[model samples]
Target: MTTPIVAFLFLLLPVASLAAGPGGVPLRSAEVDITDQASLQRGARLFVNYCLSCHSARYMRYSQMGKGLGLTDDQVQDNLMFAADKIAQPMDVAMSLGDAKRWFGNPPPDLSVVARSRGADWLYTYMLTFYKDDDPARPYGVNNLVFKDVGMPDVLWELRGIQVPVYGEAGDAHGAETAAIADLALQTPGLRTPAEFSRDMRDLVNFLVFVGEPAQAKRHRVGLWVLAFIILFFIVSYALYREYWKDVH
Candidate 1:
């Protein structure tokens, strides 16, 4: 019990310790739960729908996802198997690297290990903070608070709605302009409320975390069993030692 609790805390610390990026955009805690299968499933659906068109999780396979997320082959094949021909196929896109680069001005990065590279909190905040841009270069552009002038548009705009940045004057008598987001104000109402959208983002991030290290939940389960075996062996060995000592005495 204590071991699991300790393991859980260790899992959370990376998110807990995340700091804001440049432009003073703070990170929101992701609070990803690898054990929440339902949440992960919802997140998987969201990822496949919104992100899979552009991004690829090349290292992750549909078959591996079924095992990791406790889905049956049929469930995975029917629901999550979009671009992959076989269940064992990796999560790659139909779009080639050259096409993606031409379209987006740069190739979209593979997301297989992104959660490990950029902590979950960063992803969570970035997902939530995309706003309709005011920059002249991309006046209709959708920019991210965390990564300014982000290439990817607001893919979840319909679900979470359009957010516009709330700016404030800072650090000068003449009031210099800055891209820093003081707060986010939803410009258009979406299918889900802000609270609901936050939960959806949480689920999406949770799935990413699960994909980043599919064995994490399994490791936790196996660790408990391993500890139990060790304890039982120790007790049996102690009893045998006591019996041998009794005969000697």
Candidate 2:
């Protein structure tokens, strides 16, 4: 018969580690240039290659993306679009929600607002954090910190390879002299070394940043016009007020 203390310890152990643990990459630290045309174009290509199979930006039309990214309709159709889709149609993934759920146990979330909702940093970090663990219970023999115990596999594992984590201590930071530690370092390195992996992650993040606000260029141009109009209106109002005061005096 097992003692209650041993059972309590077993229950408490994994929970304690998971609560403060950190195996996934830190995503909130990447900085992306959304307005870089080359970067945006590269990002679009990468998205088509890696993510379009499972995820869709259902809110974005192909033509709108073409216009925003300065690509021609033919280019959007030939390169970026995977479906037999009309150029004017919104982006949709090949798989349906039901099919995705059946295969992966959950449908992949729509990416239309992921950048704005999760921010560029989180996305960037998440793309780089798929390490290999032979845990069958996890959906993909891997897990992510950005979306804990997510259903999606590390789809880019071929390029990235199996990752193992090196663990460390949290220590004194949260009060206890020997506080629980939840830090991770890379264990089994991948095909692309750390620097290359980081760059690819950045590219993906940059693309998502562009998707989040495709009209950013137009907004910047319109902003200047708006500011100019406001300044001119303020000057005219000041002159009008001065004229009225002069007549009264």
Candidate 3:
């Protein structure tokens, strides 16, 4: 009984660590489902079109992604390959390091493990909360809700639409002073409706999570089987122990 309790507590450790957000801001739950092939495909397409130019997932191979997402080689080449030349190649960006530094003030970090480094919820909220910037010298005219004064521009602005920050009564503490985003209003309509955009972001985050650990789904399946075997073996051993003890009694 004590051993089971200890095992249960150990399982809860990872969940407890991820419960709090940075600066105590609540991170939205990503609720990623790696088995959802359609969502992964949509995320892959979105990533290739909007994010691939700047960010590289060099650790991920296009063929591996196709297999994981249930995409055919032809489909991946047609839809998920924008700047890349072939389906067998790694996900490399066309932008040079010097060019990226000059354009964005710093090189965009590789996103192969970003989903693992930053929780899915944080990534989801970070991508969805880009509001129009108040500053003039800022090239992108937008900033993030989660990451204040973020250097990267809002690349999905056209798809998600422009957002304006709404300020509450001054000194509300959760206002701009704390870099807290009180609220955001849609300033201009985008290609997708609000609901559609949210779904798109969710899908994108899901794909990023999958990319971070391509074998995650398989690992989970294997883990379940292993757990079942352990339980079955334990039950059989206990029964045998009882039978052996009955003779002695």
Candidate 4:
């Protein structure tokens, strides 16, 4: 049993390494709270306005999202139900797969479970790290620190502003000198300040986390009740055992 457990632990090492952020870059903490309804509302707005154009959340319905986020049916219908006529319909894209492939080289992936698969940290870092690139060959004139050679353009550029990479010298393989991105600098300011943009991104990540598990909050509540009942049962059982054993002793 010990040997089998040791072997299993070794097997998990590669999986842990593979979970590291892209290019071995450290991921920033999303610090998202799924219980924050206001943040989820903001994130929902951002997702619908930007991501829904290309990507679809097929597992998530407008009615479900509205109920989870404390939104009214009217609000959801008026603001979020763009691609669907009915509130019960799933959040989907208007862009066809063929058109998406032609434009983006691949169909944009469905985002219903993206938060679960990619993790909140990766998504947050990816959203924040897009910088201006002069590479003419690349479809998007932007690159990301988290995802190098990324195919998608920075859709939130208007809000986050144009950023450029600050390079520094680094030793590459074979002891050769190479330029590496040391940091990012804002080349042009956008409508929102850096602080405000960060806050909005947090909200967006928060919403994605909620979408990944809409019942998580309720589940937590149920879990607390279960634990409480278990504790109560244990106490009563112990009392009964003491009462019976006292007479026997």
Candidate 5:
């Protein structure tokens, strides 16, 4: 029984690795500039336009988004909010999990904690790594370097264009893996260039960061006071310790 169980576990390893895709890269810290209101605003717009179709930020409220992005209730209602939205209600997309699973084979997961779950850099890299792969089994026929053979379609492919992998010697001593975008081409030339595209990704990541911890801004603001108190406590404790040591000496 133990031998069979071990064998089964070994079999799962490759499948798990494949599930992780090319580099088995997970999400990591990103240099997303959340302080930039314009960038955050742009990210909010892009998220509603592109991502809201499939994914939902169930943890966030529409009113919270409006407040964070400096938009009025009217603006959020007119432009960003979809469905029979109530300002106090959590911002959930209309797509049901069952319908999503039926359509995409895997239900799109809630993205409220995506930044927390995958980190900023992973999301950033995943967004940029979609390349063309003519696999019928794949809904998008696209592969990602970070997520590997992901089931989700590359919805931004038109704006980012197709990418092709640049491979190195399979079992080389260095074991290097590299890929580059073919011709730096985009299916449609947008207002943004490659650098700008990276910036856009950063912005989207910022919104995710915001969603991950709604109180993060407040927490950070309070952290300084906490740190100062801790420092003072440590200093007082050290002084008491020194006095005791001196008396003993």
Candidate 6:
């Protein structure tokens, strides 16, 4: 019992670590709903349009994604198959690893299981936290509150627009006056309103969560059936046992 408890605690360690953003900032709620097929469809479109250029979801095949998202084969081929020729092909990028490494300093990591490794809240916060910084050293001229000095540019900038950090005075360890980011202000509005952008991000995160475990919904349904069967079997077994022992009694 103690061993099982210890193992369970160990498993929770990673989850606990993921709760905080950079500088121990608490992560915002993602509010993802994997069961929302319409949201998943919108997210799939967003992913293909924006994220697919840099990242690959190679663990998942186009055909599989289509089936999971309730998209037909033709729709997948016409819309989401920009990088792949066949529907059965995985969501691989056209860019080579060497090119990606040279361009981005490091190759963008595959996002097939990113939602599992990094929780939906983390991803959602990271997406919304990017703010403009005029630091010449930074490649993208942008930084994230969740991940400072992030290499990846804000791909959704066109939709979310330019945001600048508002700073406030704070005391450091040595009691010296210092500046800290108090909040983010949108310097320029984008194609989508803040509310719309947030909704889009939630949808994207939802789809990513689905991608992490495509069979999760099915698994849940199956588990419920299994539990029901066990209950029914126990009732029948107990009734038979009582009936057999009645003569002896």
Candidate 1 error regions (>4 Å): 1-18, 173-180, 214-249
Model 4 Cα shift for residue 162 (angstroms): 0.2
Q: How much is 240 displaced in model 1, in angstroms? A: 48
lDDT of 6 at 246: 90
Winning candidate number (lDDT):
6
Tens-digit per-residue lDDT, 187-241, candidate 2: 6566787788777778778878777785445666897797668656766776798
Better of 1 and 5 by lDDT: 1
Question: Would you list the rank order by lDDT, best first?
Answer: 6, 4, 3, 1, 5, 2
Q: What is the TM-score of each candidate against the true structure?
A: 0.76, 0.68, 0.75, 0.78, 0.68, 0.79
Please, what are the lDDT tens digits per residue for candidate 4 over residues 1-249? 356445644653535434578557888889999899999999999999989999988878899999999999999999877788999988989999999999999679988878877889899999999999998977889999988888898999999999999987788778887778888999999888999999989999888888889544565689779766865676677679888999889
Off by over 4 Å in 6: 1-18, 173-175, 215-249
Model 6 clashing residue pairs (backbone): none
Would you list the C-alpha lDDT of every candidate in the order shown? 0.84, 0.72, 0.84, 0.86, 0.73, 0.87
lDDT of 1 by residue, 87-185 (tens): 988999999988988888868898987887687999999899888876679634888878777888788999999888887554466665553457889
Output the lDDT of residue 242, model 1: 79
Model 3 scores what on Cα lDDT? 0.84
The numbered model that scores best in TM-score is: 6
Q: Candidate 5 clashing pairs?
A: 21-148
TM-score winner, 5 or 6 = 6
Clashes, model 1: 0
Candidate 3 regions exceeding 4 Å error are 1-19, 170-180, 215-249
Which prediction has more favorable TM-score, 3 or 6? 6
